[model samples]
Target: MTEQRVAIVTGAAQGIGAAIARELAADGHKVVVADLNLEGASAVAQEIDGVAKLLDISDEAAVARVVGEVVDEFGRIDILVNNAGLVPFTPWEKLDFAEWKRVFDVNVNGLYLMTKSAGDVMAQGGYGRIVNIASNTFVAGTPNCAHYVATKGAYIGFTRALAGEIGKHGITINAVAPGIIASEGVLSGPHADGFDYVVPMQAFARRGVPSDIGPAVAFLASEKASWITGQTLVVDGGHTRN
Candidate 1:
């Protein structure tokens, strides 16, 4: 039987975030389902018998307050999954500064703020696991997605650097770069339109799902990953491998 632990997963309302929350809860962690979508978050949290929190990852004060609440209620946070991210498809040739900043605000800056606030609590506890969600597009060099790819690239770099700085504190920081997760939003959004033509993932035929990325996150957030940091686990089912 798995030991009971407390976990906080950001962006837990939908897509890969929801899957990760369910996976961790199944692993016996008291999962905290957090997202900007309160109703969505509540639904998932109830499904998993966990708590829900409405959070804007881009806001530092909100991040601090949410993390603080989790610690206060759970007594300890065993795992911190920085899964909140935004993937705005913008071409560099026409990318406006505002649009670029908006992407970074959620993807890059949000990750950093969460780490800063949550890292302190984890450090005090003397042990923690931090699994950051990255993207395989950065690895595959997927075109026409300059902003999304760049933010994820920065996340990978941050994961490695943070791992180096926090290892001594008994916290591990690693990243999971998943291929196209065929979530409801993805299938109904831009990727479903004409975005699939350019980046051909013919080998897999079908797109990757949330469940496909869950186990990787669970592993990285487990004690088994104590010594594994400064690495990016790419789970694209050979989509980006070619």
Candidate 2:
């Protein structure tokens, strides 16, 4: 029988993060829905019979506290999904230093802090899976979103380097880069018009959804991917054929 694992998915209040949380739960793993939106996280937790943790991943103190609490309650964390991030659409000329910092705070620094804290615990346990959420824009390169793409590129680099360092402890770290997913946030945000432009470009000729990403994340978190590490699985329905 396969042992039930404990997972922590950040930014799980909605969108891709929420879908990953549900997918992991359906796989029979005890999931922790961590998000800044406490109510949303709690609701998802109830739906999946998992735990809800209010977290601001950019804050080092908050990240440490959540890791400690989860470890104390669950004994060990087997999966850590760094899915929490910010996506801002602004032209490069208008993208100020403050805006760039804010984006990196959640996308880059947040992932680093979470990985450092959780990876330490996983190293001690001698088994762990770290899956980071990146974007396909880093490969194809998009206009008006340089900061977001740079952060994802940083994630890929970090995953490769960290995997080499932590593989000795049986911890595998990888990344998933999704195309323009039509999640609730994108549908109502300024990027709605982007779908029309993106769909025609995709080889699949369909808009990507949140569910499309869940299974991929689940696979990376599974024992079946034991030998896979420091890789980026692009799930964009062949949008960016890299």
Say which candidate scores most in TM-score: 2
lDDT of 2 by residue, 183-218 (tens): 877887787778888888888888899999999999
Question: Model-by-model lDDT, in order?
Answer: 0.87, 0.94
RMSD of each: 1.7, 0.8
Regions of model 2 farther than 4 Å from truth? none
lDDT, residue 32, candidate 2: 97
Mind sharing the TM-score for model 2? 0.98
Quality of model 2 by C-alpha lDDT: 0.94
Residue 41, candidate 1: alpha-carbon lDDT: 96
* Residue pairs clashing, model 1: none
Tens-place lDDT per residue, model 1, 96-143, is 988888988899899989899888888998898999999888987876
